[model samples]
Target: MSAMEGDSFTLRTGLPEIQRDDEIEWRFGSSRTRLTRIAVGNITTCNDETFRDRLQLERQTGDLTVTNITNEHTGVYQLSIIIRNKKSTKRFAVTVYAPVPIPVIFSDTSQCALSAERSSRIFLCSVVNVSHVTLSWYKGNSLLSSISVSDLSISLSLPLEVEYQEKNTYSCVVNNPVSTQTRHLDIDQLCQIDCDLCFDSPEAVIRLVVSALISVAAVAAVVLLVNDIRRFGRTQTMKR
Candidate 1:
């Protein structure tokens, strides 16, 4: 059985309730260290301080529960039930894993976009401080690419390329044995970048409007100077 850390897990005895004459014992690990034993309607727990205050036993059901499980709680558990000289043994294999972290999708133009491929952009799906997880890129429901990390607490990145006008859906998913986190691609946001050049930018449009206004002002000034000169010449001729 696989369980997430900080959660509770129960090892069932398969019996609805414990009988008065029945004896139940639960052990842990390869050394067969005793954890709990029920005998003669009495329950007893071990003094293993490594799992201090984290073990619970249901007196009526002969079930053992571990609360707030951590890496130390991951191992094989053994259960023994004795009734009328008949002994039955069961073993449970448990694995505990951390919660999967959310993946972030961002543009990676530092080196990949140096070709000036304005129509297409490079993006990366990344997760930090993660281990034993798989990071993947998916186009809609189809898998595009993936990368995995094991045993090392390192970061992971998966690259993907798409057109600026892409209409299809995409998502980044990171998952472990028992947990998964997904981030949907917002083409208009993370894929959004500066215009191909200044000509298509809002600043460029503003500059064009300013230049037009300046040209009109200069033309008006020239026309006024020409009219003033013509009036002066007429006045001089009339006076003569």
Candidate 2:
């Protein structure tokens, strides 16, 4: 089973009742370190630093509940019972995952303005500081590709191609066993103008303002030159 950090989960021993003189022992981790034992109406708990004060065991049913689980709590847990001089054991595998962060989608349209044969548009989906999660690209309701990572301290990224003149819905999805997040792509809003110039960054806005001013100044200069030429022609005619 899977759990997120700070959550609680139960591992069932599947035993309905404990008979008198029957012994039950709960162990955890890769080495099967003993966590707790109950026998003859007495309970003994291991003072191990990993499970100290964080685990509870049912006396009658032998079920275990772990509270405030952390990444270090991920491992195999075992329940051993002895009845009628016979011993039986069961194991439960637990996986604890960190919370997945929301993914950011970036459009790389630098070549969108080039010739049709040479231009290609790409979208990248990225998430930071997540683990045991998958980042995926979806076209409409179908999945295109996915990338999975188990390291929580690193980032993950997935990419998809956006064909020119291709009309379809796309989205980036980031998910773990406990949670999911999604970001939709607005193709129309992004491709309304030249893809290379579609982004309204501060630098792009400044360049646009400068270009507009230069165009206005050039028109004013042309209008003044035409007026000067006309005035010169009139002065020459009057002198004649």
Q: What is candidate 1's lDDT per residue for 105-180, written digit by digit as tens?
A: 8875453335443667777889999988999999889999889888889989898888867989999999999899
Judged by whole-model lDDT over C-alpha atoms, candidate 1 comes out at 0.86
lDDT of the candidates, in the order given: 0.86, 0.82
TM-score, per-candidate, Cα-based: 0.77, 0.75
Off by over 4 Å in 1: 111-113, 193-240
By summed lDDT, which 10 consecutive residues of candidate 1 come out lowest?
191-200
Model 1: how far residue 107 lies from native, Å: 1.8
**How close to the true structure is residue 178 of candidate 1, measured as C-alpha lDDT?**
86
> Whole-model lDDT, candidate 2?
0.82
Which ten contiguous residues of candidate 2 have the minimum total lDDT?
193-202
Alpha carbon lDDT at 10, candidate 2: 93
